[model samples]
Target: MDLDHEPATRAHEARLWRDDGWTAKVIKNGDDDGWAVEMTQEGEDEPALVGPWTMGRDKKNPKPLDSAAFITLVKTASEVLRRHEQQRHALLHKNVTIDSGSDRLRIDLDIIPDEYEPYAELSAHNGFGEELARVRVQPGFKLSRESAADWVANNFARPS
Candidate 1:
């Protein structure tokens, strides 16, 4: 495919391939005397998926990469990246709902995974979704029912 006047490269070598914005390469397994395959997306520095590779007919050589295998590897690598993003999202955003007198409060903790200045935002909202309080807390702050309750009981002050 041609885009921006640049044609996308498409290769199907025996142990390497580059197509559809992904590249698959066969490498020696570090843990054992076997072969492994790594799939990396274009322009990325790291491989999205890496796993064992099948042996060839001679039983001593790694199986040559083919169109079908490359396609499967791309799909698998895509899924791994998708799941990793989902897990990161879950870890960075958390919330808990607790009862405070007759009113229900929802406490949210959003972690900012900055490289140098990591921190988190702790906020509380009422049942009607009105903001009650917000403060900056440590990035590793634990958010749970008890913690949320304690924050509310402490008048929404920043937790230490």
Candidate 2:
């Protein structure tokens, strides 16, 4: 997020309209002579989508925002953000189960790709849902039967 990527875009002319967690702002398109609209949601730093804007009757200025059109834009933009979040959630979290001697152990991996610090956590849970171990590993840490077995055998210390 952080539409702040463009400082000038941070503060533009007043928004034409806003509804359903979306704000629509029309701006002159830099690539072409036509205008473009940006739809941003509350708490999100970036706009969900941006595309060409329709022209008004004058055929020179962009068309004014209307209730029906704005509502449609809100739904489309919301869907875009929702799908993005879901995809990231799937990529950041992973789970698996492996047989550790007799009792089965559930393994979970969560990755945090921070700008300054990227890391992943590997955790083990017993059949009864008791946490056996949690260790911080590199972002590229591999989760597999062999790795889980090593962790369980090494008293939870991170594999060398």
Say which candidate scores most in TM-score.
1
lDDT of 2 by residue, 85-138 (tens): 999998898878888778999988899999999999999999999998888999
TM-score of model 2 vs. true structure: 0.72
Q: TM-scores, in order shown? A: 0.80, 0.72
At residue 30, what lDDT does model 1 achieve?
Answer: 89
Reference-based lDDT, residue 44, model 2: 72
- For 1-160, candidate 1 gives per-residue lDDT tens digits of 2345453488889999999889999999989989999998877879999999998999889999999999999999999999999999999999999999999999999999999999999999999999999999999899999999999999998999
Clashing pairs in 1: none
Write down the lDDT that model 1 would get.
Answer: 0.93
Model 2 CA deviation exceeding 4 Å by range: 1-15, 43-45, 153-155
Candidate 1 lDDT for residue 52: 99
Model 1 residue 127 CA deviation in Å: 3.3
